[model samples]
Target: MSPSAVKRKLSSSARSVSPPPLRRRTDAVQAQRAAQTESTNHSHKLNFYSWNVNGIGPLLQKQISFTPDATYPLRNFLKAHEWPHFLCLQEVKINRADTATQRRVELAANAGAQSDEPTYSTHFSLPRDKYNATGFSGKVHGTATLTRDDTLETAASVPDFDLEGRVLIHEFATIPLVVINGYWVNGTSNPYRNPDTGETQGTRHDHKLRFHKHMLDLCKSIEERRKSVLLLGDMNVAPTRIDGHPNLRTSPIQHVINRADFNLKFLDKDSETGLKGIDVFRHLHGEKKKYTYHGRGRPWGESCDRVDLIVASRKLVDDEAVVMDTDICDNPHDRGHSDHVPLWVSLDASTWLNQSESKVD
Candidate 1:
């Protein structure tokens, strides 16, 4: 079936399941994507970036132990790549003391503090309940989007199934460029296992599965609108061995390799699209072991593996999106950034708009 047709089918099916609030949000998202995709042609372009900044607190702390200064290194890096039209950031944590409105301003100021010009506008999704709580500080975890242009549209932060952090979305100048910033829950190596039931008995695994489902659902919904989608974030789960640690072959992480509920736990196994709507870090590099996570110690003390990822819709690839891995920092100790490396992809926004126009003719 055609890609657009596939999207519609998914939407119709999702709607059949209650079709009220979920349907409304999905429908609005679909319309927004469609409208964004049709807005401009070649003259305008969008650049998307994603990274997991482990925790903003450590970087902003008075005395830090890590090597590379997080604030300075990241700021310099952004300054160097100053031309990206749109940037998506995962793990853009915000302090609860600040309101959402206040947080965005702080982020913008922070970005500008590191750049000569504040070329990016910020958008984020924080926890709803936390914002409503009495004397609530602000969201603990979430995602944010930054763009050179002030054209980000209809931005929303869809809380994922885990209810841990936020997944963010926005349009780049109404062009068929819809960017999603995500930070999936990081898996716990020593999750609380029921002594009687073992590791398979808890809500941890279920939470991971729910996170994947939420991501897939969003991807499918966006595909339904047939826009060029760029889903970027710290995915936490490696789709393949190349994106995992080297020791995985001999002694694999049981939870990762097991296909028991693989289809439900990872994006590589969505039955309907079956990973069609997903692409990952492995797509850019065929390397292994080089990881993004370091055991909670110092930045480079003990390494885990690559969990961060940049996924693009197959439709976007066909539209000539220049997707690649931008492994900006190697040593978290040196950069004072997150355990994960920042990954970026550039899409020729004009190309999609122009091609769509041609098809109309």
Candidate 2:
């Protein structure tokens, strides 16, 4: 079957439960294979860069830059370390009703490569007025993913929980990995009232919790298919207190609930039914006090939290030296300032991808 046909069948058949994925192979065997491959092979590495642009339209229009030194900030960022194979974004703030701009973005991204499958594939999940509790007024939540790799087979959103443009999942044929890029809802209960009717219906903490649940469910479903998952984006909830700085929650009921849920669902490696996504930054940094988001009009160091994350499945990272480096980066140029900085990871794709398909000629 064609790749598209296979994607369609998978989506339609997602309702039926599949048998659990088989247990991983022994680590001794994995290490033997890793010893044969160079950990520093640039050709066998895939670099994934993720940032919640806060508003992507400005970046596209050149109205803003991640830094001051470059006219095209994206170009500067791409070459900052290595070429970013996949650029995953969050908080795109694009409304669902706007189709014109979406089409334009696709056109611009694939301008030169005009094939049925362009050199770049872009997918955006935007918020719709009918689907949002606050009625999708002003810039809200959204997510997008762009990839130039031809192995990208499908791009999709979470089934029932995708109305707010919070999640985007990409499946690639050449790799044994699924990428789940999400911009999770900030935990808030602010209500938006109708100007005249005084009828109020805004978001509550429940909405945020439900979004987390749906993303986890999607991860579980994908893992059942025997593909490792890389879940990355602005998850919003800090799993531990150390993640927050000057963290003035002082133990609010909301914090307690949110933290506990995150711990069990994503952080807990022992949970038989949880997503079990290993926190890549924490795993590498080891309680290092670094922050990704600066809030409340505070400078980065004074008040911030590492809300942005890059979590990978255990199966994908178990091999030694798969994760080359993971770090939280700040703006090198002083021109434009965004609250959230970029988080990136470079990994040896050959370590996890099937050896036969790992190398691309």
Candidate 3:
């Protein structure tokens, strides 16, 4: 073959095997990575429910010592609403010493079953007898949380605050979240009566100062670890004037203190020195009036305040897959039980479970 013909054939081979332009190669790689992320990511709707049951006894049994009824108010709740992934109960009024009572509460919570294995894992933060000094039993202020058995990586209560059975912290197995369930101290201004002296002592409002400061720290601790937080249960604070009916609080100063603390430190979106906790309700429905707690016998709308809340971390809210819906249940129940009605939030399963699920119970 001639030298010119050989050279031409070599040039053709080189042109055929040439690499793609840099931009094209980069875009191809980016498209492949995007596809992988899209495949792994998903949208989910997970329901979580919370209620201040007042007492666990009435739902399962007429009294703590009696047998649980065949049908219960708790049963009515579960059947009526989407079976929640986590059910947070506040003011359970149970003590650690009463293991039997705790077990009964657990049994009723897990579909009121006495024989079947429990589908939920129950965790309670029981109270100490510190208040016994004031002629009141500390056993009346417990907080509890129940989730599916496999959902937790770790679980605990606040060491100092839980003496009144006020808090439970849960780290989940499937999400980068640390959940806190609390029955926050009620800052009632009525001074405790000393039966011995027939006189009054300082108010329970003192506990409020400490309880809230620690609550802020707890959220910060989770934020420091780069994990999100979802805190729910009866916080006992109305948060703003619109959150309460006028004059519902007997202690305005105490109420003001608490409302300020919760608003400025956590729920304020413009906060520069906070965990930037998102009030799930306010985030979804801005300034729309809603109430969760009602006066015992009055009509709900006539006299009530919205004290129950589900607050989330900014990180969690920023995630596109996690849809937090504001269909909070504040109503006359299918079966009326507690003065404080049930409330809940919806989360997408794809945000954690990486799959889609049925929206219904």
Candidate 4:
């Protein structure tokens, strides 16, 4: 079936099921403030979705089944969530030399061709180093951003950080907003070594720290310009103990341990600038044990963590620009889609965009 037909079928199926209720807050004052804000700004909202698709090439291949009931997770996801104006994807793993990879990119770029859905202007950042002599094919992994046509005025990648195609930045034409789609370096395999001692300097832990520092500096520069920024991706870090699996050891060898440390540094308020970030999902759904990634291909036990996240500038968080319902799409039935599920956020564009304009004036 065509994309449109698949969407129509899914729409019918979705109507039979009701969504789960949101958790209630104990603080009455906070609830009252949120109610007031919701009443005032109910008209303008923009949905954003971020997924580390694991690999676009593989997803496209798996989605080509002939049976009607065969699970085409990626295609079904796109059809079901038509509200997202911006879709950010990571670990696309599309190399320039692969023709199949080129075809998959083209299909994604022209996703709305046969339907009434809004077309997206796709931008990709492939690895700068084409040849992979290091045995680790870091050059094949990449990130992508697909924004509604005419929505973006400027788009580019960070200089040093773009080496492995890990980051893509998009600036909107009318709004003072910058959306950064990133696939942070997974330092698990690349151990940091000291030149003088000829021993392990910091292991994968040190490599991740350096990566976070670069990301922090880049985000700081954008916020310095007074733009309301939304940075979303597989950060590869779970902020606290609450975000990590309880059974996992909090050791240097453990990825969660090192990643959590860097997460704190990234979210820390700068002494001079006083800028900070708010993890939107955790802010809304406090202490909810939602896991976005399942480690070692285990279903969901002690190996899961909420590594995928959407972090926004404090200005946007303080202004109540986020429309509360953030989620981790962890569907066990759709295992073939990816190991890491998608995370999404809804933002009140009218409120934030106006506030940003006033800052300029």
lDDT of each: 0.49, 0.63, 0.64, 0.62
Better of 1 and 4 by TM-score: 4
Clashing pairs in 1: 36-174, 36-175, 37-176, 41-350, 42-350, 68-333, 68-334, 96-137, 96-138, 97-137
TM-score of 3: 0.74
Stronger candidate by TM-score (1 vs 3): 3
Tens-digit lDDT string for candidate 3 (115-187)? 3222344667776535432123445877776664322234444555456677877765445777788888787
Q: What does candidate 2's lDDT look like per residue over 109-140, in tens digits?
A: 43322122213345666664353534446457
Q: List, residue by residue over 1-361, the lDDT tens digit for candidate 4.
A: 2111111111212111112212332476434543443343234567789988777755554455566434334444655776366788898876644444544553544433333333344567666543321224543567776554322234444456556677877765456678888888766656555433446666655666776778778878887887777889988877777777765445556675565556565565554532378888878988888877875456466578788889888877786555556787776643346788788998766655455556656
Clashing pairs in 4: none
Query: Sorted by lDDT, highest first, which candidate order results?
Result: 3, 2, 4, 1
Worst 10 residues of 3 by lDDT: 2-11
Q: Cα lDDT of model 2 overall?
A: 0.63
Q: Give all TM-scores, in the order shown.
A: 0.64, 0.74, 0.74, 0.73
lDDT of 1 at 30: 44
Candidate number that wins on lDDT, 2 or 4: 2
Segments of candidate 2 deviating more than 4 angstroms = 1-42, 62-71, 103-119, 129-138, 149-158, 191-203, 248-251, 319-321, 331-336, 352-354, 357-361
- Candidate 1 lDDT (Cα, whole model)? 0.49
lDDT of 2 at 156: 50
The residue ranges of model 3 lying beyond 4 angstroms of the native Cα positions read 1-44, 62-71, 111-118, 132-137, 150-160, 190-203, 246-251, 319-321, 353-361
